[model samples]
Target: MTKISVIVPVYNVEELLPKCLDSLVNQAFDDYEVIVVNDGSPDNSQKIIDEYYKKYPNIIKPLKKENGGLSSARNYGLKYATGEYVLYVDSDDYVSSDILEKMYSLGMRDNSDIVVCRSYAFSNNNLEKIDNEILNNDVFKRYILNRPSATCKLIKKEILLHSELAFFEGHYYEDIAEVPAFCLYAKNISFIDDYLYYYLVREGSIMHNKKYSDKLNDIFDSIDNLTNIFINKNAFDEYKDELEFIYIKHLLHAASLRFLPYEEGLPSINKVCEIMKEMFPNWSKNKYYKKMGFKYKIVCSLIYKRKFNLLKKILKVN
Candidate 1:
């Protein structure tokens, strides 16, 4: 069997698809297959996929399907992944050549259910490394309580199959729902300190698109789903602190985004603030909350206080 199956969900990112595919095809690791799910991209993304498929037919498998969202594309690709481990790569992003080799080796050596590595965030001509400190066996806690991105991880296929995990379809911020579940279900996890993935910061991306606020409810739904998962496993008591922290942080983020210049975003922001209050009535007292930067602390206080006008003014200034 292949050592890893790299799943790339392609949408309308025609301009950025080649760089992503090039990085994958030129990877130092050869014992892996690249499953490119063409999510009915309206652009020339399929043409690029076809080009790569022809060039590296043995390693690249292109699956064409109707336009489902990111979650659907990833879930579709999962069905045909034949490797022992799976790695998700966004079509708009690229990775270091040695990423697969290093991550795959760590997974095998540690017999880990998941292997994570550092990543870089790039925009225009600037690059910033995101170096997350990984604590022992606390991958789930760290993920929910801190950094949460599905990329830069080599996940054992068995854990995903056994957990019957699938990204929530037709949702924005689907990774918020799916990645934490993987971390929670993982038995053993490993981390490599080296920076391996390049996350492109593009203005047109889902996260940057202000109009995507309409689907903001999906973020809360995903968080609720994660909470229920912990409860079902009777792990809630053990992870309550981390879970509460995550809820508060994520709610604040959503609320901040909605508190922007757009009027349509206000309703979602208000809703998120309500949920945040209900989830953690004393969120302001959280140690993590207290440790937050002055600006963020102010934002949190304003949101908790339902001071939208002040929050908007602060956001505009910042």
Candidate 2:
């Protein structure tokens, strides 16, 4: 009889909102409330929400708020949520029919603070599943090394309330920064291999949308925040090597994105090189750091900075 509050942040996702809501409504789980936060979307998303609000008056509660970012919308929804367990489902994404019931049952049986499930990512022509578990006995280690997404999971409301965990305002990659910290703070965590969440990959979504030069910086900041949480908490020294691997992979991806013509001023190649050097001085040892053709990797290494000599040295060593 555990009540769950499903929070869906409604932005300008009018086209996909109905499908998302329909999936939720059709779920086998009955003891749940849906809280949809309307974050000043300019589109007819509000109209659609209103239609549903009228139809399902008792189960659906709509909270209208001015244009604050996603974090603000979620924080606003939290205030009105009355369920013992909380789940976040983006307006643009939909879940499998049994996700809520399965996640809730798992959490209840395990007395878990956080419950995670496998997720499917769908593009127009391709689909992929991400369901890897970290081998180390530590939950935080598993999170840092793999299973880093927020959408493929469920959490206990009391855990968040007791820890006072709130999303960082006006930031993208907020989940990346917050999810790891939650795992670190949690003592009871459980995972199910079953698929629950489906991330429909629109070609032009925000995360994959218009290239912004500063996007790399946002990504770096997220990694830096996640790293700081672990360091400050003094969780375990064994994670340092694994963390460096994660950092290198993160920087490489960010640095690659800078090569595209994003609107923001091109991040100084030097700044990226500087961060790569400071954070991951030696990348060859990191397991996930892939080995590319010597010159290609070296050139990529130098794209962050204008130091041809350093690139030369790396090229020579390789």
Candidate 3:
């Protein structure tokens, strides 16, 4: 029988980790092991991990490591995993009881390298389900042209090994870079329509930090890394536009935040524009770029400087 390894990276999610673990502990499938890596969390996360380890010793293996961020924690967990397939679960997120059974069954039955399912986000008062079309569409192209999150997917361990793929350590947007490449290398994929994962949206999370302001060069640097991977793989020409569009959208969001006035923001915005010109010089002619209008342009113009008060007067950021 094939086994699945669930890699969950633990951090300072003491408040929500219990619910996440409870859901996993009760999974309908039994041929699985949960590899929990504690990424130097300062809270009571260690205590919780210890409790679970004692209760489910055979299924749960706990490893304590220094703070190395998300990518590092995942890489650490990968080494201890013994399952034929792997699924990544965030410490603050939970999964449906049947998620493992369904994902594993589908992957093995269909001989697929990747198995993807629908997921939803739970906030204070809202729940948003990701579109179901992902499981039905051409996953590789959709993945390249759209939002690609790894949490809702099950991947074959061999593919990662064959491709020598590991999450880029020390990076904030590792998934935003790695998941697509993994899919591009995939030969077969299976899709399940069920909402198998529950992603918690919490403030103070690394992804939600407002301090992740736009560093124009860094942003371009990351995009270039992914683009080069795709181009070298001999992916379609369509990827160039898709990659550029993705960066442009990121730039737009970073620029639009409530911050200092245009004067402060303009430098970053101008820097983004410079990168965009280098990546997609014809972006101005693209319908989406043209539709951004003056509001977006103004926000970009004020990315970094000492004009906070002026920025607030014009936009309701955050």
Top candidate when judged by lDDT against the true structure? 1
Q: How would you encode candidate 3's per-residue C-alpha lDDT over 71-162 as one tens digit per residue? A: 88988888888888999999999999999999988988999888988898898868899652422155565655445566888998877664
lDDT of 2 by residue, 33-93 (tens): 8999999999999999899989887778898999988878888888888888888888888
The TM-score between candidate 3 and the true structure equals 0.82
> Residue 261 lDDT in model 3?
34
lDDT of 2 at 177: 67
Q: What TM-score goes with each of the models?
A: 0.93, 0.83, 0.82
Error of 3 at 207 (Å): 4.7
Q: Which lDDT tens digits does candidate 1 get at residues 1-318?
A: 889999999988998899999999998987999999999999999999999999999999999999988889988998999999999999999999999999988888888988988889999979998753434355667655646677888888877674436787887767777677676688787878899999988887555665645665577788777777778778888877777777777767653564455676667777777887787787778766666679777877777677877877877733
User: What TM-score, to 2 decimals, does candidate 2 have?
Assistant: 0.83
* Candidate 2 wrong stretches, greater than 4 Å: 131-137, 162-164, 210-216, 236-238, 258-269, 287-318
RMSD of each: 2.1, 4.8, 4.2
Q: How high a TM-score does candidate 1 get?
A: 0.93
Candidate 3 contains a number of clashing pairs equal to 13
| Best-to-worst ranking by TM-score | 1, 2, 3
User: lDDT score, residue 187, model 2?
Assistant: 73
Count the clashes in each prediction. Answer: 0, 3, 13
